[model samples]
Target: MNLSLFILLSLFGTILSALIAFISAKGQGHRAVMILLALSTGVGALSSALFLLSGQTQLIVLQSAWLFGTPFVFTTLSALFFFLLNTVACLASVYAIKYVEQYAEIYNVRILDALMAIFVFGMQGVLLSGTPFGFLFFWEVMSLSSFFLVMADKEAASVRSALFYLIMTHLGAGAILAGFMILSGESNFESFTRLAVLAQNLPPATLFGVFLLFLFGFGSKAGLVPFHVWLPEAHPQAPSHISALMSGVMLKMALYGFLVMVFGVLPAAGTTASLIVIALGLLSALYGVIYAVLERDVKRVLAFSSIENMGIIFTMVGVAMFTQAQGLSDFSHVAIGAALLFAVAHAFFKSGLFLGAGVMVHAAHSRSLEVMGGIAKRMPAFSGAMLVLALSAAALPPFSAFMAEWVFIQNIVSNLATMQPLVQGVLVLVLAMMALVGGLALFAMVKFFGIGFLAEPRSEHVAHAHAPELTISLPIYLLAACSVAIGLCAPWILKTMHFAELTNTVQWHTDFALTNTTLNPFALFALLLVVFGLVFIARRASSNIQNERSYHTWDCGQPITSGMEYTATAFSAPIRFFSHMITRTKKQVIATPVLATNKWIASRTFSLGLRQIWYDGLYVPIQNTCLWISTQVRKIQNGVIQFYIALIFIALVVTLTIAL
Candidate 1:
C-alpha cells in the first residue's frame, strides 16, 4: 500500500472505531469497539514507522490543491513526528484498556472512546499537514480535541483549567496565523515547499518578525517560560494516560513546528536572532526549575520540569544556530544533535515519570506530595520506575539525559571559547546558569521521588500502596527500558539519528574521546549491582541483620512524628527562600501568641501558594484590556430589535461613506 494512503486510512480507521464505540454504548458492543480502537492505533503506528524507514514516502496528494497549491507532503520531518505521535498514541491506547475503564462509570464510555480516537487523529493531522494553512487548520483541530479531552472531567477545576488552556492556545493560534500570513505575503507561492524556495526573496527584517511571532506561538504551546501558565493546570486536569501523551509527545509537535518553520525554511542563521533565542531559553530554564523546586503538587512539578527541559533544548538550538551562522558548522552540528537527543530522551523518561506519578496519584487519590511518602516498600515496581525516571531527569551519569546535557554543555563551552568576546562572555554566563538549573532540577526530582516515596508514608492511604494494572505498568516499563538503552548506546543511536541530514549539511561526527567522558547506562547499572552484592555479602558474613533494632526517625533526641519529617514544603524551602525575590512566593499564616517569647509554641497554621511570573506580568494585563473592550461592546447589544436595526443602518451608512 502507498504509505500516505495507509497512514490516512489508519486515521480513518480511528474515526470508524470511534463511531462504532459510540453506537455500541453497552456491554459486549463497547468491548468490541475498545478492542478495535487499540487495533487501529497499533496498525497506524506500525504504518507510520514503516513510512519513516522507507525512502519512497514523498508528498502524495490525497486531494486537489489546498489553499493555492499547498498540497500535503510526506517529508522525513513530518513522518518522524507522525511516527512519534502514533507510537505513543498506540501505547496509550493499550494503557487505556485498564485506565479508561476505571472512569467508565463516571463518564460515558462512548464519549471517551470517540474523543480518544479523534484526539489521535487530530495529532496525526497536525504532524502530517503539508501547508501553512493546512497546518494551522489542523493545529486548531488538535487543540480543540485536546480541550474537550481536558474538559471531559467537567469538575470545577477541570472546567476552569480547560478554559484557561483553550483561551491561551487560541491566543497563540492567532499569533501563529498572523505569522503564517506574513510569511505567505513574502511568497508568491503558498505551499510549504514553495514557501521555502520563496523565502529567499523575503527581507531579513520581515523574516525576523515572522520568526519572533512563531517563537511566541510555538513556544507558548511548548510551555516555554513567560508563556507557560496553563501547563501545570492542564496536565493535572487530564486523565493520566492523556497526561502521558501530552507531556511525552504533544509538546514535541510544537517543537517540530518551530524547527520546520524557522530553522528549516529560513536557511539563514543570524547573530541577534540567535542571542534572543538563547536569552529567552536561559530565562525559561531558570524560571521553570525554580518553580518546579517550589511545587508540592507532584504532577505540577513534572509539568514545570517539562518547561525546564524544553528551555534547555531551545538554548542548545540557539547556540547551534549562532555557531552555524558564524561558520562553525562542526560545533553547530554537535549542539543541534545534542538538543534533538535531549528531546528524544525527554520524551521517554518524562512520559515514564508522568505515568509513575499517575500511578502514585491513582493509588493515593491525591496530588499533594506532602500526603504521599514511603511507597517504596509497598509499591516497589512503581517506585523503581520513578527512581530511574528521577535519575534521568536529574541528568545523572549513565542516563540518556546526562549524555544529552553533556553534549549540549560541551557545544556551548566550545562555542563560547571560539566566539567574539562579548558573545563568548554572555554564552559562558548562560552555560553557567544552565549548570545551576541542572543542579536545582536534581534537587527537585529527589524531593519528588524521595520525600514523596522514599520516607515513611505520610498519610494513611499512601501507607497501603496499590498497584495499577499491567496495562498501565507495561508502557512505563517499556519506556524506562528505552531510556536506559538509549543512554547506553547513544553513540550507535547518534549514527542512526542522521543529525546533519536534517539540515542538508555535511555530517560531523563526535570524537570517541569525548564520548568516553560519559559512562553508559549498562556500565553504571552493572557497577551499582556489584556494589549492592558486596554490601549484601558483607551483611551476611557479619550476621548483623538479626541484631539490628528498628527505631523511630531521630528527631534531635525527641520522638519523631509525621509532622517532624521533611514535608514536601520543607524540602523545597531553600529554593522558595532563594527564588522568592524573583518568582515571588506567597504565604498565608494564622498565629495566636499568648506572650512574646521566641521559644513559645504558639497556635499557628500556614499554607503556601505560587503564581507564575508571566501570569502577573503579561497575560493578566492583556486579559483586563480584553475584558474592558468586551464590556464596552456588550453595552452596544441592548435587548431591542430597533437598536439592532439602528446598528445595521449605521453600518450601512458607514459602508456607503467608505465606498463613496
Candidate 2:
C-alpha cells in the first residue's frame, strides 16, 4: 500500500515468483509464472519508483544483520534505476510468456523463468543496498543468474559465451571491490555514506586510482569499448526477452554504480580524468556504431547500438565532471540530467527494439538479417511500432532520444561563448565526434530496418511469417509509445526532476507548450502527428478506392524475385570499403570463365567483412600470455608425492625463516 511495502513486496515477491516457477513447473507453465513476476515488478516496484521520481523521495533503511549487518537504503538515483529495471522487466515478462514458449521444447522454460526472476531480484537488491558488501553480493546474484540464462540453450556456443561473460564480469567485480576497499580506507567502513566521507580526505592520486577502477569496473558492465567483448556474444546466445533485459535494464545498473561513485562518493573529477572519460566515451560511440553498421545479426546490432547509447550517457557524465570541476554547478547538473534522461529514454526504446527483434527472429526462425524480409507488409502494425523504436534508437526527431541528445548538445553550444579557447576547442571536437556517431547510428538503424523488414522475402521462412500474440505485441508498442510521450513531455519531466534535485533548469520553462520556451517538443510532436495522420489517411483511402491491382510494366515478363533485393553484406559494403584501415576487411574471390573463348563471361563468388581486429590485436595476445603462464605453472603440478612433500617442506622452512 505504501512505498516501503511496495519495495519490500518487489524484493520478496521476486523470490516468490522464482519459487513458484520452480515448484509449479509441470502444472502452471510459464504464462502464470510470468504474470506473477510482472505483477510483482509492475505494481510494486514500478509504483514506488514512479512515485519517487514524481518528487516524493522516501528513505527506507532496513537492517540486514543476517547478511553482513548493512542496511538497505533507497536514494533518488536508486529509485531512478528501480523505475527503469522494473519497467523493462515488467514488459519483458509479458513478452517472455510467448517468446519463451517457442523455446520451451528446446530448453527448460521453468528454469529459465526462475533464473530470470532471480536476475531481476538481484538487480533490485543492488539498487536497494546501502553498502559495497550488499552491492557486490547482489551484483554476483545478477551476474550469475544471467550467466545461467546465457547457457540455458545448452549448446557449446552458449556455454562458451557464458564462460566468457563470467570471466569478464568477475574481473569487473574484482575491480569494483578494489575501488570500494580504497574508498573505505583503514577503518573498514562498508557504508557508502561513511566511505564517501573518508574518500574526501584521501590523496588526489589515490582518489584518481579509485576513479579509474570504478570506470573500468562499471564500463565493463555498461558494454563500453575494450570491455564490451562479452555483451554481443552473451546477448545473442541468451533468449531474446532476456537479451532485452540485459541491454535495456541490466546495463543501466553499471551506469547506476558509476554515478554513485563519481557523483556521490568520489569528489569532482580533475581535467585529466574528465578528458580521459570523454575520450573513452567518444571512442566507444564511434567504435560501437561502426560495428553496428557492419554486423548482420539482429540482436548483435542492438547490442552494439546499446554500446553507442551508453557512450553518449558517459560522455554527458564526463561533461558533468568537467563542469563541476570548473565551478559551473548549474551546467554540471544540466549535463548529468541529460545523461539521466538519455538513460531513461534508452531503457524504453532499446527494450522495445529488442522485443521487436525477438518477434522478428521468432517469425522468421533466424537471427541473421540476410534471411529476413517483407515483415513490413505482413505485420504492418508491429512494423510501425518498430519504426518508432528504430527512430528513437537513431536519435531522430520527435522521439525521447533526440530530446535527450538535444539537451546535451544545447548545453555544450550555450557554453561555447563563455568558455576559454582551449575548452571551446575541446567542446567543438566533441560536437563533431557526436555528429559522426549520430550519422553512423542512423545508418545502422536504416540497415537494421530496411534489410531486415522492408524488402521482398529473402528466404522461405520469412515468406510465411505471421503476427505475434497480443501478449507478445502489446508491451513493445507500449514501450514505443513511451518514446513519443517522453519526447513531448521532456520539459515537464526535466522540471520535475529539477524540483526533486535530480536535474537542473526548472526555471527555463514557463510552460512547455508556450511559444517562449527554448525548445517546444509538444509543437514538434503535434506537427509530426498531423503529417503522419494525413499520409496514413491518404494511403488508406487510396487502397480502399482502388479495387484493381496495379502491376509493374517495366518487368518485361520477368517476375520480381528476392535476387533483386540487396543483401546485408552488399548494403554495408560501402562502410567496409571506406573504413578498411579500421575495419581491416578481408576479401576472397574465386572465378571460373564460362569458356576460354568468352573471356568476359565468368561465374564468381566473393566474401568481404570486418576482421576481428580487437580480438586479434588485444584479447588474443592476452589469451596467449595467460596460456603460456598456465603451461609454466603446470610443470610444478607433477604427479609425484615425494616432489610435493619436498615442495611443502621448502614452503614450511621459508615460513619459519620469515617468522624468525
Candidate 3:
C-alpha cells in the first residue's frame, strides 16, 4: 500500500483540526479539538506508520523520489519514531480535554488547543523532513509553537523562560545547519542518503568537527548536561498537558537526529567518540537525578527526572555505539533495543506523572510539595493512577521501566565474564552507575508520592480537595496502564525487533535473553499480587469502624499545623547533608541570644539554592563575557559627525586599496 497518501491525508486532517480549534468559541471547542486531534494525529498518522512497519502491504512509502532531494522521506526507522510520536500525542490530546478548562477563564483555550495540534504536526514534520531546509523549517515550527505555549500564562518568569529557550534552541539549530553544511560540502542541498556517501570521503579532522557540532546541536535539545540549562527552566512553564507533550514526545526529536547522524549519515566513528558519548550520558544522569531528589517544586522535580531518564537513554545509545565500533553486534543490538524500549517506557510514565502533577497542583493551587499532602485521602482514584506512574518512574517490577532496565543489566551481567578486560571494566562502571541512578530515582519518586500524597494535609487547600472530573482522570489511568502493559509485552517486542537473533548465536531465552539470570515480569507480577492480596486482607480484618477513634495530631490536640508532619524538605535532609557540596545547599545564622554576654550563641537558618555546576560554571561566565564584549563594541557608535566622516574616509581608502 502507498503509505504516503495516508500520511498526506493525516497532515491535511491535522491542519483542518487546528483550524477548527482556532476558530471555535472560546469555551465550546476544546472537546472537539481533542477529538479531531486524536483522529488525525492519533489514529490517522499512527495507522499509516504501523501499517508500513507491519510489512504486509508492499510499502510504496520507500521509493527513489522519496529519498534523493525530496522534502520528506521515510524508512522503517523513521516509521518507528512516527509511531511513538503519535502514540503519546494521542493520549495527551485526550487528557487535555479537561486539563485546559482551568485556563479557559484566564486564557483563550481554543487557541491553546490549536497550538498544541500544530506543535504535534511540527514534530511529525521533523521526522518526515528529508532535506535540511525541510528539517530546520519544521524544527522552528515546533520550537516556536512550544515557546508560545511556555508564555501562554503571560507570567514574567515564563516570558524569560521562553526567551531563554528560544535563544538556546536557535543556537543549537545554527550548529545543526553548520553540521549539515559541512557534510554536504559543495552540494549544499544534498539529500541525507547522498550526504552519507559524501561523508565517507571526508578528512578525519573534518568528520570529528562535524561530530562535535552534532553533539552540541542535538545534546542541547536532548537536555544533556552543560547544554541543559534551558530544559528545567522552560518545561515547567507550560501548561501541564503541554508539559507532558514536550517532555514525552518532543525530546525524542533530538535522539532521532543524533542516531541518524551517527549510524546513518556518517561513517564509523572510532572508540574515542563512543567513550566521550558514554561519559556525557553518565554525567547528565547523575546530575539530573541529584537535583530531582532535592527539588521541591512538583513540576520541576519531574523536569529534572526527565533529564535523568534522557541521560540514561543516551548512555544506552553510547553503549550501543561503543559495541558497534568494537565489532560486537550482539551487545550493540541489545543496547540499542534496550534504549528504544526505555524511551517508550519513559514517555508513557513521565507523561502520566506530569498530568497527575497538574491535577494535584490544580486542586491545591500550589506547585510546592511543602504545601501538598493527604492527596490520597482526598482523591483516591486520582492518587491510584499517579501511584502506578510513580512506581513506573521508580523502575519497580512488572512495569515498563523495570523490564527496560532489566534486559540491559541482565545481558551485561551474563556476558561480562566472557568479554575482554577493557570492555569488562567499562561494563562494570556502567552497570554500577545504572544501579545507583535507579536507586536515586526510586528515592525521588517515594518522596514525590509519599510527601505529596500520603501524609496529613499540610495546608488548608489540600484539606477540602476533591477529585477532578472524568475527562481529566481517565487519560491518566490509560497512560499509567501502558506502563504495565509495555512491561508485560517486553518479550514479544524484543522478539519482533530480532534482539534474540542478534544477541544469540547462543540461543538466548525469552525473558533474560543471552543471560543466565531469568526473572520475568510474569513472575514478578505473581509475587507482587500475592503480597498485595495479603496486605488487603489484613487491612480488611484489622478495621473496627464501630469503635471510632480520633487523636490530636498537632499542637497538643488544639489544631493541625504544617510543621506537625514530615515535610518534603525534612525528608530530604539526609541526602542534603551527604551531598550538600554537589547540590550547593547552604545555611545561615540568626542571632537571638539571651543577652549581650550570650550573643555568641545563635541559631542557624537554612535557605537552600541550587547553584548547578552547568548553569553557573558554564553559561553564566559565557553571558558575562558576551556583555563585556558588547560594551567594548558599543564604543564604536559614539555618534560624532567628525569621527564618522574620518572613519568613512578611512574605510573608502581601505576598500580602494583592497580592490586595487
User: Which candidate's TM-score is highest?
Assistant: 2
Evaluated with lDDT, which candidate comes out highest?
Answer: 2
* TM-score of every candidate relative to the true structure: 0.89, 0.92, 0.90
lDDT of each: 0.78, 0.85, 0.82
Candidate 2's displacement at residue 282, Å, is 0.5
lDDT of 2 at 557: 75
For candidate 1, the TM-score is 0.89
True lDDT of residue 653, candidate 2: 100
| Alpha-carbon RMSD to native, per candidate | 4.6, 4.4, 4.9
Write the residue-wise lDDT of candidate 2 on 1-660 in tens digits. 466767787777789989988987462567888998898888655665566665654467477585677687766778878888988888899889878877777778879989999999999989888878889999999999999999998999999999999999999999999999888877765688788789879999999999999999999999888898899889989888898999999999999999878766787679889888888899889989999999988888998899999988998888878767777767777778778889999999999999999899987888999889899999999999999999999999879999889887887876789987767877888899999999999999999999988979888988988888999999999999999898888887776653233222212221222122466888887888899999999988878556777765466678888888897778998987788788887689988898999977998989664566777789999999999999999999989999999999999999999999
Candidate 2: regions farther than 4 A off: 26-28, 499-516, 533-549, 552-554, 586-609, 656-660
Q: Model 3: per-residue lDDT, tens digit, 313-428?
A: 99998998887788877787778778878888998899999989899898789999999999999999889989999999989988998888888888898788988888888889
Q: Arrange candidates by lDDT, descending.
A: 2, 3, 1
> Model 3, stretches more than 4 Å misplaced?
25-28, 56-71, 497-517, 538-560, 586-607, 641-660
By summed lDDT, the worst window of 10 consecutive residues in model 1 runs over 497-506
Q: Which tens-of-lDDT digit does each residue in 512-555 have in candidate 1?
A: 22364564556777898899999999989988778889877667
